[model samples]
Target: MRSCSGWRRFLLCFSLLLIIFHIFSVFEFHPNSVIEIAPKKRNKKSDHLVLGPAAGQGLPNRLQCQGSKALNKSHFLTPSNASNVGDSISFVTVFTIYSTSLDSHADDKSSNLVTVGNVSYTKKERSMAILNVFINFIEVTMPQSNVIILADPESDLSLQRNKVTLYPIQGEYNRDKLMLQRIRSYIAFLNTRLKELAQNPGHTSHYIFTDSDIAVVDDLEHIFQKFPNFHLALTFRNNREQPLNSGFIAVRGTPESILRAKIFLQDVLEVYTLKYTNASRMLGDHLALAWVIKSQPNFDLRRFSKAQAFIEEIDGASVLFLPCATYNWTPPEGAGQFRGMPLDVKVVHFKGSRKRLMLESWNFFSSASDISDMLCLILMSGRTRYDF
Candidate 1:
């Protein structure tokens, strides 16, 4: 009788704990039948007033059906089926950085500095340190993946063979509106790749477009396999006002997919080219994405409900809407209060004030060591949390 009572008590306590954590972020999603779009067109101030800190500050960078089963750990959401990524994958990013040097290697250029949480460091050193975390993390976690970097011609990123490729963005862009320019450059690169790969009928590529300030912690390539039918995989937040973020986009490439993507991008570009309106002003890519979708002729709000939350058929291709908390995980609070996150998290975006957390997270999650990054770590985390 005593043993049974003890077991009952433990089971009851465990059940309560699970219920509590489940409320935080769970995966029981049934997306709405009628998919809605982002609302960037309705609100754009000519003065370029943004919701949060300005774009250059960082220069970067969901639930199932509700009532029926209630999103739980039961059988966490899976994409399609497991398969080798093979040679079909490439990770693309837009990272604008200057020549970087570390401690004592400083020169006159080093005087222009950027600090990460009170730590004195050159802007380039800090940017490189953050970039190293992504580069090294990708090298380890997704060894088969290839990388493409889009940056200013002036920014020199010493490269290696077929693993990493650099495509320089040549021309002048207003520093005040750099984010808009960055997005334009990124889409241009995609267009260029589509043109180059048009003749390669034997192969279909999978491209993961991300911001440089992001570190992919999981084998994100699996997304293409899991959600095989999607042409564009995007991340969205629960917030209705700014629901979609383009920091992590996975393109499941096919000939049709390429054409559809080009068409969609063409419309996004129109927002910038139309000089009369403040096109990609405050919101940049996120705004352009939402506005374009809403303006599309086929966009019918009546079609989306919740049963089909993640995947949507829009434009000419299927766009998979992934939850931001998991794929593009950003710390809700500062690093000091952050312990760690579940390994289920595939990517992390260090935006705005949270850019400082990159080094702290890299040390905790990645095995590769860099004396340069470690040196900068001395100033950051008071308590590092790990959700493993």
Candidate 2:
């Protein structure tokens, strides 16, 4: 009886050992099956503005429906599909830059408006002139998006281009009320367009409104493609903390964005008209936008660094303020000042005295080649000529 009992116990022990070995073998073959791994910890000091898994990737309820689904799918919200989703991925300009230069021998002497003292252009002439230059450059560059020009009413600057649209203002604009008046006009125009675009289902939902003084020497589609999440994209001339550069403004077609822009426009009007109503005193929509950005915290604004724009490839493009010299280059503002070698300056913004001589400045600093020539000429000319 004892031998039989020992035999049964031995068999049971053997079976238990076999079960343990089988379990160990299974784990050896498939080690990760039973292991639950937690995701890596996100760094606090990371520069990237992690926009979260894009639009439709199990995002929260609010983001899922905010006209971002189309953007989520392709990650490229441009003109072709921008309208379908109520977005704007195109370029726009108000083109109301009236030259205050009183130079008789100006480079842009073909147009009376460009000459000193005769600073008035018929609406048609101004529109035609602006489009003539703008279209030439964009045509050469493929993937040319649509361009919208908002001008004064009497100056019904109408011309038909494959991608150009002109809208005339109905009200009598006070040309003397320069910056403030221009801001009001632009705000009104932008608001109207936003509403129209929102109602329509076949146009883009983003618009890059640049000043007439802005010169584009290279393709700017890359600049537009940089920031997909920002409600507004602009550069700062003076203050980086609160960038209010209205000269180059990129507005998104979202309602929340337009509302903020409206608030900013009203603020600019108040500042320029109520308190500082001096036309010559340089007030603009940029300051108003900056003020709103400072006062309000809800805006998803992106202000780029002046230096990053010139760099060929930016590492963390999410925080790109603007293309600085590349997208919006101003000569006196150190854009073409790098070792006397101008980088690939795409857009030359004629601000300050530069605005008065747009053609001269543009010709001198249109591209890296032009800038190089300019530098060579400057070196050849005596220091006294440029000093004072």
Best by TM-score: 1
Q: What count of clashes does model 2 give? A: 14
lDDT of 2 by residue, 1-388 (tens): 9999999999999999999999999889999856444122221222111122221224331112222122222132233433232233566676442443323344355443333223344433443454555654444332455677776655534356887777766543545555565676667877786677678745455667777656555555555465555555655543554455667766666665555556555665675555455532355455554554455454333433334532111121121256454466554422122222133545655454433234333334344333333323222221111100
TM-score of each: 0.63, 0.53
In order, how many clashes per candidate? 28, 14
Report lDDT (CA) for all predictions.
0.58, 0.48
> What does candidate 1's lDDT look like per residue over 194-266, in tens digits?
7777755667777888887776655665677677788787777655445677788777777667667666666
